[model samples]
Target chain A: MSPLAAFGTALTALRVNALRSFLAMLGVIIGVAAVITTVSISQGAKRAIEEQISSLGANALMIRPNSSSRGGRRGGFGSGTPFSDADTIALRDLPYLAGASGTIGASGTLVVDGINWPSDVEGVDADYFDIRDIIIEDGRAFTQAETEARARVVLLGKTVERELFPYGGAIGSSVRINNIPFDVIGLIASSGQSSGGRDRDDIVYAPVSTVRSRLSGFRYPGVRDPVNAIWVEVRQGYDVETVTAQLTDFMTAQRNLRIGQEADFVVSNFADFIRARNESEKMFSVMLAAVAGVCLLVGGIGIMNIMLVSVTERTREIGLRLAVGARPRDIRNQFLVEAIVLCLAGGLFGLAFGAAGAYGVEKIGEFAVSIEPMVALIAVGASSLVGIIFGFYPAHRASQLNPIDALRYE
Target chain B: MGALIQARDLRRTYRMGGMDVHALSGVTLDIEAGAYVAVMGASGSGKSTFMNMLGALDQPSSGQLIINDIALHERSADELAAFRNQTIGFVFQQFNLLARTTALDNVGLPLLYSGMATKERHARAAHCLEMVGLGDRMDHHPSQLSGGQQQRVAIARALANNPRILLADEPTGALDSRTTQDVMAIFDQLNREGITLIIVTHEDEVGAHARRQIIFRDGHVLEDRR
Candidate 1:
């Protein structure tokens, strides 16, 4: 018989017991839906974390003084010998060092048009904006001349800009930090929230010299114009860990410490931290995939069971067909086609269900999810493959039945 | 004219409980075209076994069985199936009509396996149903039809592929006497139209309708008369 005719016969058979056919397809539907939903959710989470990590600058590393221990008295972190402008400039000439900038920051209340809002204030060199990937949305960044002149010009982050100038016009406006008036020269673009849910846009930036000289701050021992931390940008194609080791060595030698002695500074790479997070997310995705795969396997087994039952129940019908000259291959094709069509139908429904499930997860679970067309295609293809694999044995059994015996089957 | 069916020294044996049970042994027969024949025997007398051999549903252990000039014994199982499609029509005592299907589609079942196009298959099925006096009940399912009407649908299904020989294993066995006469009348009419008929039954009244009768006893033909 032609394949089209075989398909028609299978369809009619399925239609005769529509409810049973749907029940047979339930397992496959749930399986494919689970695969799509889990993959999309995990993929969305990975992308979100990557974006957050990239916001911190992929090639950048932060260096800060470690906690100090002197005479059995331990001090908090960033209490050791702080970095200065000269120390940052010294690191700029190192191999693969793209830029170096010393940063000092303090939190204080800002008063703009009598609206008081508390936020952090940071003093940085001109290259700090590039190292930290901070973009100026409204006005230009302060130049080297401004830093040398200790200009009282400042840049407001998105959150501070929105709060201090709710009706706009924050740029070129004067804001008082620590009761000292400073002009807002630029508005920093939003960097969104961190993975830890911290609001990254609630800060302001000013020249390092301006903040060191104007803003009151304690200085480290014997350090001229001390800064709390130094941010370094490594050139493209350079490894952050290698540069970090070189920086630590340079700092150790600058401090006149022995070769094996531990440095008094700590260097943190954002890439390493995010890599650990990505690994965990990948593990979570793999676990969910395994569960979904098991669901699909169970679904395939369900189809096989149902098809076998169908063959048994229709034994007499099979006998009648064989008597009417149906080839064994014809009988096999009819049952096999029934299975494939059943799974393909389930796959289409599962795609719809998975999309709805993904949307539901994104809304209720507050997760990012997306369904790719390729994923949908593969899901359908996988269900059909499952049908072929599981449906074979029962179909073969039906085809091998003795015509006379099958006719006599009760 | 050459005989339409020829069998020589036909023997069929079964291995049951590690013992041989001979269903047919050293039997021989010949049937001409358009012949109306009945094979009769008591239970376990081998009439049904001989009928199964005649219908090509089972192969004889030792025999020269030829139908329509084709040596059925030498053919493969698949080839026998094809030969049956082209040459034999079968009607069982149970009618063997597909449940949940219309009479028309049930009649077209054979045509479907023969690879006839759907439209042509349906047309031929309709014609066969009309010939069997079931043309008006084409759309009725087997459950919706009476015993006699269901038998008529089965007969029409058997005729769908225009087979040269009709094989019925107790066609009227499951019907009331009244329905039996009605089904037998259709068989007579089909044989009158030159389609060879072979019916298996133990009832003398049913066998009386055939022009030829053969009786079996203990796996051998005890009587053959015209």
Candidate 2:
């Protein structure tokens, strides 16, 4: 029979058993939906990470003191001898360095107009804003003169601004940090949430010199200029790995570490962290897709089972067609077409279901989930393939039936 | 007219539990065009096997069978299918109309394999249904039709490809006496139109309606008369 006519016949047969057909298609529907949903969510997470990494300054690097060993119990990172201000100056002088700044932070309470709020107090040099890509929303960043003169000027993060001056005039206001009064020179723009799930805008920024000499009133024993960490930004088109290697070598030599001694510092690149996160996320997506594939396989098996049952149930009908001069191939085509139609229909429904599922996840779970058009297309294609692969055996069995026996079947 | 069907020493054997069962043994016959032949036999007499060979639904085990000048043994299965589609029409005891389908579609089924366009297929199917006196009931499904009407729809389907022969296996077996007569009358009218008719029946009254009768016993023909 003509392919179109066979397809029509198949459709009629399926329509006659609408409930069974839908039951057979259910597996495929759920399988495709799961695949799309998982891929969308993973992709959304990857994108979010990428945005966070860029916000953290794509070319920025954090240099922390290595762990310190005392009585064989090693302290965590940044527990070794802190870097000196001379080290920051030396790193800033590197030809490939775009900017560098030193930082020290401690948790403290800020009070303005008797409204006290607990927040992190971070001390940084003038170049910290440029190195971290921090945009000032209200007032200007700390000037070089302010940093050199140890001015008690500070920058308020969005969260601190909102908490201290809810009515909006926080810039140029005097806020006391740990009972030390400082002028809020600028309001930092909001940067959403950090990858660690911490609020990014819940800290305060002040000059590192003032924080070390005035606020703390303490210094590392025998150390002239000590700082907790150094933030560095590399110039465009510069290799961060090469710059990191140079910085490591320079720091090791400057610290007088012997060849057998381990360096007392670590240079961590934000890009490397982003790459690692993406790799893990990709692995997670692949695992989810594999699970979805198993679902599709089960769905395909269900289709095959139903098709076999249908073939057996309609043996007499098949025999009648054969008696009326239908070729074996025609019979095969009819059943195969029925299977593909079921799967394709299921796939279309699954696309809608998956989109709804992704949207639901984003809304309810508050997670990222983006459904790309290509993913939907691939899902449909995969479902069609599943149909053909699983539908063939039953259709072949139907085609090979002896007409005499089939007609004689009760 | 030339012989429309010729069988030379046809035999059919079946293997059941590893023992050979001879269904058709050494049967030879020639049927001319426009002939109305009734095949009659008791149970296990091989009448059905002979009919299957004549309709190209089964191959003879050890003989030659030709229909419409084409040697059946020389054709491939697919070619035989095509030959059957173009050359023979079949009607069964149970009517065999596809349920839930309109009479028009049931009748058009054979034409679907004929590579006919949809419009032409429907037109020819409608014409055959009209010929079988089911023109007004073309839109009715099999469940909505009576026993006799369903039989007529099957006959229309058998006639859709305008084949050279109509093969009916107990065409009136499922009908009442009045309906049997009505179906037989349609067959008689079709025979008058110069289409060959082959009917298989055990009922003497049903066999009597044909112009020729062949009787089988012990897998061999016992009587042949016209």
Candidate 3:
């Protein structure tokens, strides 16, 4: 028989037992859906982290003080006083250094009229906004002169803006932070949420000099204007690791620390950290897809089982066909086509369900999810492969049945 | 002209629990084209085995079988299948129509296996159904039809390829006497239309309807009469 006619016969046979056919396809449906959904979610998360990393600043290194060993007792991370505003200014002239900024932050309550909201108040240098890629939605970033003069000007993050200025006009308004009034110079644009699920637009920014002199009283008598951390942006076309190694050497000599000594500062590349995270996420996604592939294998076996049952059930029909001059090849083709149709149909349904599932995760779960067209194609291809692989044995068995014995079968 | 079917020393053996069961032991026969013949025998007399061999559904262990000028015994299984498709039609006592399919589709089934296109296959099936007086019942499934109508649909299916020979094994065994007569009348009409007809049955009344009768005893032809 022609393949087209055999296909038609397969379709008719499946339609006769529609419920059983659907039941046979259910495993494939779930398998493909799981694959698509899990891959989409993981890919979305990886992309989100990539975006966050890029937004933070490419070729940027963050230097923070590590635990200080005092009297042979080690403190937690960022416990030393190794970094200050002077160190940040000294690093500005280093090779491949695009920009440098020092920042100090503390939790404080902001009051506008009678309303109040608790948020992190960060003090940054004039170059902090440019180095961090922070966009200004209103007004302008604090100028160099403003920072030198210790101007009490502030920038509210998007989330802080909503909380402080519900009726608009927050750019020129006066808001008191920890009972000290400061001029609202600008509003920072929304940066959305971080991959870690933290709200990125919920803090406030002010000049470092202003925060040190007024809010956080001077601490160290020897060093000038101690700061919490230093952010350094590398110039374009410069390798961050080379620049980082140079900066570490510079800091070590400036602090009079030797190689054997436990240095009080730690310098890290932000991109490396995030890329490591992204790689792990990708590996996790692959593992999940592998699990889904196992499910597909199970589904293929289910189809094989059903095809076997169908071959047994239709022994008389097969016998009749053989008696009417159908070649064994024709019978085999018919059943094989039936199995492929079942799997392909299931795969299509699975694609639809997976797309819907990804959408649901994005909407209801508030997670990033994106489906690739190639994933859909691969899913379909895999299901077809499954059909061909699992359907072969049963179809061969059906073709091998003796016509006389089959016809005489009860 | 030469005979349409010729068998020489046809033998079929089976191994049953370590013993040889000779289903067809050296039987020989010749049947001319357009002849209506009945192969009558008691059970285990090898009449059904002979019928299976004549229909090309089974191969003889040792013999030569030529049907419609093609040597069936030497044909491969696939070639035998094509031979059966092109040169023979079969009707069974159970009226083995595909259960959920319409009478027209059941009739068109053989044509489908012959790789005939849909439009032509349907047209030929409709013509065969008309010949069987079942043209109006084309859309009816087997369960929706009476026993006689089902058998008629089976006959229409057998005629779908317009085979030169028709083989009916106990065609009226499952029907009432009235329905049996109706079916026999159709067979007589088909035989009169110049198609070779072979019926294998134990009933004397059914055998009497054929133009020639061959009775088998102990895997051998005991009588052949015209």
* Top of the candidates by TM-score: 1
- Candidate 2 residue pairs in backbone clash: none
Q: What is the TM-score of each candidate against the true structure?
A: 0.90, 0.84, 0.88
Candidate that would win on DockQ? 1
Clashing pairs in 3: none
Candidate 2: which stretches are off by over 4 Å?
A: A65-85, A95-98, A104-193, A196-228, A234-246, A252-266, A277-281
Off by over 4 Å in 1: A70-75, A106-122, A134-139, A152-190, A199-204, A211-221, A348-357
Candidate 2 residue lDDT tens string, A1-410: 77788788889999999999999999999999999899899988988888788788888999988998889999987888888788899988888899999898767799999999999888898898888888888898888789889899999999999998999888778999889899988989898887567899998898888888877653777667788999999888899899888888888887889976888889999788888879988999999999999989998999999999999999998888888888899889989999999998888888889889999999998897888889889999999999999999999999988777788889
Individual DockQ of the candidates? Answer: 0.72, 0.59, 0.71
**Each candidate: what lDDT?**
0.90, 0.89, 0.90
Model 1, docking class: medium
What overall lDDT, based on C-alpha atoms, would model 3 receive against the true structure? Answer: 0.90
**Candidate 1: pairs in clash:** none
User: Taking the tens digit of each residue's C-alpha lDDT, what string does model 1 give over A1-410?
Assistant: 89999999999999999999999999999999999999889878888888877887888999998898999998999888888888888888987888999998877789987899999889999899899888888898899899999999999999998888999998889999989899999999999977567788999999998888888474766888788899999988887888888878888887678877878888889878988989988999999999999999999999999999999999999988888899899999999999999898988888889889999999998778868888889999999999999999999999998888888999
lDDT for model 1: 0.90
Worst 10 residues of 3 chain A by lDDT: A215-224
Please, what are the lDDT tens digits per residue for candidate 3 over residues A255-333? 7898878777999888898888888888999899999999899999999999999999999988889899989898889
